[model samples]
Structures are given as structure tokens and as C-alpha cells.
Target: MSIKKLLFMVVAFTLASAAAQAAPLRVGVEGAYPPFSWKEPDGTLKGFDIDVAYEVCKRLQRECVLVEQEWDGMIPALLSRKFDTIIASMSITEERKKKIDFTEKYYDTPPGIVAKKNAGFSQSNMAGKRLGVQRATTHQCTAEKMFPGAELVLYASQEEVFQDLASGRLDAQISDSLQASEGFLKQDMGKGFAFLGDMISDPGCQGVGAGFAVRKKDTLLRDAMSAIIKGMRDDGTYKILNDKYFEIDVYGK
Candidate 1:
């Protein structure tokens, strides 16, 4: 009956109402992209993208729902509404822009090549050699255009590409530099292999690094998440996540 008690009850009710109305943000992730996202032996998803997704949803005050999707199907699954947004490390390429909108870049590592130590491969001398790349990715585009002399082999996942490279089925492989270092090169199977040459420079195909993809009409969601990404960088939250997965800042200059 007191005014103080009435005001406290009103605020509590409002808070509870807002909590009840908060919808879950479904995030699409490739559970096979190492360091970015991958599955554990028990099938639990963990990686940089997984961590970022949870953090973004936490800041947005929404329940986080992760949708596991294959790399090749990421955009199609997004367009079909299988998930509300893609937290997958998908590049912001011009070709993909036609199908979906992207948040501002979350990270901008360059693509690089992995080849056996002492291999006499060069950017212009890979004729008849098999080069592996993830299908439908910026790496594939760069390899196709830049290394026309090499035979391009496509795989559904980067893991497979690394496997073929390790087994000598592939002469070399192209992928995000950080992922190649952390996911493959540092492992035992990657022994005697080293990153060859400079990072692949193809701005037209790689676009402006990686971003969250949402349905083309979901500009509001895109902007909201983009703002959260910037806040994380400003507050050092992004660095914590970046350091957990990489030795250097993958967000680029």
C-alpha cells in the first residue's frame, strides 16, 4: 500500500516482462572451421566465432541459439531462414552481397598458402600441380584467378583440404592465414610444412574481411550487431577473444 513498495513492484514487473519478451537470436556457425568454430569429440561447439556469438547475444540480452551448417551451405541456409544471422567467418565478397547483407567486418586476416617444406612451388609455376581450397569460398576464387596454372581441387571443409595436403594428394592449400597456422600448421600432421609466399592479395574477391551475414532486409539487426562488434573492440573484449585464438590481432588495421 506504501508508494515505495508500489514503485518497486512496478519496476520488477517491467523487468520481468522484458525478459519474457526477449527472443533468441539464432546464429549460424560452421562447426568445422577451426579456431573460428569446430566440434569437440563430444560434439560440443567451441572456437572464436562461438565465443563471439555468445558475447554478442549476451550484450544484446537475447538467448543465443547456434545453428550448425556446412561451409558451402552457409548463405543458402541464411537466406532460407534456418538461422536469423550467420556468425560464420564468411568474407564480405561482392558476389555474396547479392544474396545477403553483412555487418561491418569483425576480423580481416589474409589468405595464405601451405606447402611442404623445401617444395619448389611458386605463385607462377604450379602447372599440373593440385591445389586444394574450400569450395565456394574467397580462397577458391583467389586460387582460381591467381594460379591458373594449378589444378584446383574443391572440398566441403578446410579440414579436408588440410588432410589432402598432408597426405600428398594436394601440392598446396589456400586458406585464412590464421586458421592455417593454428588449425593445421601447428599440429603434428602439419610438420615439415610452412606457409609459402606472401598473403594472397585480392580485394575484389576477399572483400573487406569477414562479417556477420543477415537476410538482406534485416538491416536493423545488422546494424545492432555491428555496433556491438565495435563496442567489444573499444572495451578490449574483442582482444580477449582474439588472443584466445590467435597470436596477433586478426581484426587487421
Candidate 2:
């Protein structure tokens, strides 16, 4: 072989070896969004997002590690390279797309309002209520726009909002329908709370649905994840996870 070609081959081999030794894909999740990703009492993390991410990594032939992060800082952490990807039930919105890339949507649920059963409020009655939502979430933005007169209380997490709602600090709370249905409705703490019909609109906030997030420059990783997510949807693993958490199919045909 020519000397130039031999040198090229040696450099290529070294690069390939370095790539092979790259660390496992580290996925960041809030680890507090029940039915999506959350920590168990035993310290292990599990849920829909956890299951879906595991499937995606398996399809990509890559090991997966889950990193617990607060909801407010999840995106910034992703940009700072604290994790390789985010699977924290993040929605694909134009606002977010400007900062980071997203895989195709894997699950979806409309935004809904949860209020005390005796509150006697509907979508139209939201004018004076104190609505609680997680800070830096689409729900918070939607509540602000949809109910201009309502007091929007931004909490750090869904758990915090729910806690305040149960303790009578909040008149109502807005969140994804599936999350309200599973995490709140099914729990004892949500005994007297009810969804005031579906307040679906604003595809950017309540309609489009959820997907994983990655840095815009990680095109290879994003493409691989998108393909894996598509396969999971087609092969029914996605449905199984949905069924485990929700009574109805949130990801429709």
C-alpha cells in the first residue's frame, strides 16, 4: 500500500477504537413525573419514559443510563452536556425546537384542568381561580394564555402542585390529561378532584404531544432515536406502556 494510504488507515482505526469506547447513552429525566419517569421508594427509577427509553437504546444497541434531574433545569442540563438526551415527557414545541432538537412524538395527551370536586368550575369558570402548574412547562404557558384572569401559580414539579391543590392552596391545577388521569386521578390524594372536561387547543402546548430531546448538533443520535421510537410505536411496545399507566390510549391511531 502507498505510505499515505497506510497512514490514513492507521488514523481511521484509532478513531474507530475511540468511538467504540464512548460512554453509554446517558438520558436525563425529571424522575418525578409519575407514569412517565419517576423514582421508586427503593431508589430505582421506572415508568413509561424509562421503559420507552430502554427500548430505544436496545434497538440502537447502546446501553442506557437514567439521570434524575429537576424539571426546571432538564433542558439547560441537556445543553450543558450533562446528559446525552432527555426523555422526561418533554413536548415538541416550536419554542423548544429553536433551542434543541426533538425525536418524533411517542405519546400524546391533551391539557386538562383539575379542580376540587366541589369547586363547580368549568373552562369558562376559570376566570378567578388560582391555577397551579409546573414552572417552565407548557401547561403554565397555556394556563396563562387560556385563562388570562386566573392566578397562575407556578410550582417546581407536578408533585408540588398536587400537594398544594390537596391542601387547598390552589383552586385548580392544569397538566397533561394522561398525567392527571394516572398520577392524580388514580391516587388517593386526588379523591375529590375531577377534570373539568378537556381544554384542548394550542397544539403547541396541549395538542402535539411528547418526545425525547437532544442537542441540535447530535443529528446521528437524534436520527437513531427517532427510528427506534417509530419501531416501538409500530411493534406495540409503546401501547403497552401507555396501557400500564392510562386507561385510554393516549397515543392514537
In lDDT terms, which candidate is top? 1
Per-residue lDDT tens digits for candidate 2, residues 1-253, read 9999999999999888658834578899888888777788999988888888788777777788888889889899999999989988898898898899998888777788888876877888788789899999988778888899998898899999989999999999999878877888889999988987765678755536888899999998899888887887778887787788667776754
* Superposition error at 164 for model 1 (Å): 0.8
List, residue by residue over 1-253, the lDDT tens digit for candidate 1: 9999999999999888646738789999999988899999998999999999999999988899999998899898999999999998999989999999999999999999999988997766878889999999999899888888899999999999999999999999999999999999999989999988888889988999999999999898899999999999999999999998888999998
TM-score of each: 0.91, 0.90
> Which 10-residue window of candidate 2 scores lowest in summed lDDT?
198-207
Please give the lDDT score for candidate 2: 0.84
